[model samples]
Target: MSFERLNQINDYRQLGNTNLYVSPFCLGTMSFGTDWGWGADRAESYRMFSLYVERGGNFIDTANHYTNGTSETFLGEFIGNLRDRLIVGTHYSVFTQRGDANSSEDRLRKMVQSLETSLRRLRTDYIDIYWIHHWVFGTPIEDVMRVLDQVVRSGKILYVGVSNTPAWKIAQGNAIAQLRGWSPFIGVQVEYNLINRMAERDIIPMANDLQMGFVATSPLAGGILTGKYNQLALARQISVSEMLARIDCTTARASLNQEIGRLNLHNLAISLELMEIARQIDRSPAQVALNWLLQQSDITSTILGARTSQQLEENLGSVEFQLDMTQIADVDAINPTDSGMLYGDTVYSEVQDILLESARVVDLNH
Candidate 1:
């Protein structure tokens, strides 16, 4: 539980059911370039990357259109010698070319073009994990699976993943792919944190059942878990409902069929609890929040994003300690995730007891 331990390497584990062994934490490169204004510049990006690499982290996450392509470009420059050993993943399907019909409309062709562009940007021949970014309403899953299978066969990408996608779609798509003997999604990426446990309702359970690598993104819930918003909440006197209604939802969250919510009174209360827990444990609020995600048996990896070496240094400390069951229970009690209808402990067992009491069938999951 010291800085010395943080420098040591944690054993690499397999990602999903694949042979691809990855770090417990994935270094998110969304902040690798300053083109987004809030991101890091070349020097600071290098510092953060080196800090993560030195900490024995290798799994990296990026997107094709991040910072208008500067993120991949910066990572390309940074991974020069370690490219072969590193797990470089990138996302596509942002479609930011605006009115360019061919590039923006067709998902299949666009994925192909995006893969080529990302390969060049990352200065690599093949991406370790190629994500579809998100699911759109019109894009047929059948076509997607087939095309991605073809892409994998071509050796352009090692494996496929989905982000910001619904659990049912993932199940259906994978079932179809398995039946057709095509490559399916081996992992899923979703925003999960102390405040937003929506992923737990369906996505996490589905991932656990399917053996898909579940990578939790936005582990801090848009910096809310860092307790920065606690002071802002103190300054702004508003009701939880009013605060949520007044605030704007980010486009990404809205597009993913997520609740149009953010740092409201309820969320701020969670932030306060996080800070209080950190104070009692003598750990950073970020570490407290990050460790909770790490403890989830289902989460294969949590994305750590930082704009500076100092931030990355602090995030790396997340693995140095563990959250006791009491602390975890306290957090859960204060901010409980809803186990909605038919999910979690809500369904199945009761019905099965009555229907199959005479000769109950063995649980497939067992």
Candidate 2:
């Protein structure tokens, strides 16, 4: 592929098939408060916000329950006069209020309450995108699409998205919406990063096939991909490095050590690779990680979280350059994306030939 990367921040991409265009990096507001006991103060939060906006970032991400709502409050003050220029997104996923557990009506009430609370905190009349943060097993997907469609018609939310949800459910929900004339989900958000390519197996592909944009959250894999962390994985047992010192890379062993989480050798190896490549490219590891996610064809945007102005600056600088296919191949070699069961590309392709048994078949694709 040609290796010239357009200047990001100002480089806006459409959110799925929607007309609304947003920056490649969606500034996540989860770190915009001290209410969480460990985040940027008000002054620092404003600095980061201003820094991101000055760089031409137009999308800001938030949630109603983030830091018990302090995140939305601070973001509201920061976004005072520039409300119309930015695409504001907020979430309502956690069950926070007392409501009847009977049916979709009660659930809708809770959802609406959460949305209004977020709006009041955000100081916005209408949210650009209202994301149903996740799919709970209790509430039916049909109810969610209907309620979201109602709100969209009422001008409370311009578009609705699904985040932290399964591919099948999102497919089912969007299909239901399309068939019933309700507003289909235009986008999806999921935890995706270099260390965790699990989404590539299903979520990203599903979103792409459905014409829905995929937003990658935790693009740094909870900071493990930053290449500057050494904190041990906490448990009564040994640290991940120590536990992984045994060097059993078998599938069963890997699954058994899943409790050690993302700090395993393979993931850390990915981090080391990023560091090496960044050294060669003269970019920060954080920037390398972000740029890798940005280059993925299926990703619509990547949510970038920063607690300091320095971090924001470094991250914004990532878009000014591009990684060649060789670097991308090196990164992919660390962990080949599992294509899951019976994938013709990654697994058995001969099944088709066996089934056809030398018979000529016309290939008609929709």
Q: Estimate TM-scores for all models.
A: 0.83, 0.82
Query: Candidate 2 on 1-366: residue-level lDDT in tens?
Result: 122355567888888888988988999988888786667888999999999999899999999878789999999898999999999999874543233232222157678888899899999899999888755544567887899899999999999887766688788988999999999989999878877677777877788788898899988877667775332333425555775564344543244335336646767767777778788988888888888777876778899887788888888888888778888777656667765632123212333233233343353552
Error of 2 at 299 (Å): 1.1
lDDT of 1 by residue, 185-231 (tens): 99999878887777877888888788899898888877777876565
Q: Which residue pairs show collisions in model 2?
A: none
TM-score of 1: 0.83
RMSD of 1: 9.9
Top-scoring candidate (TM-score): 1
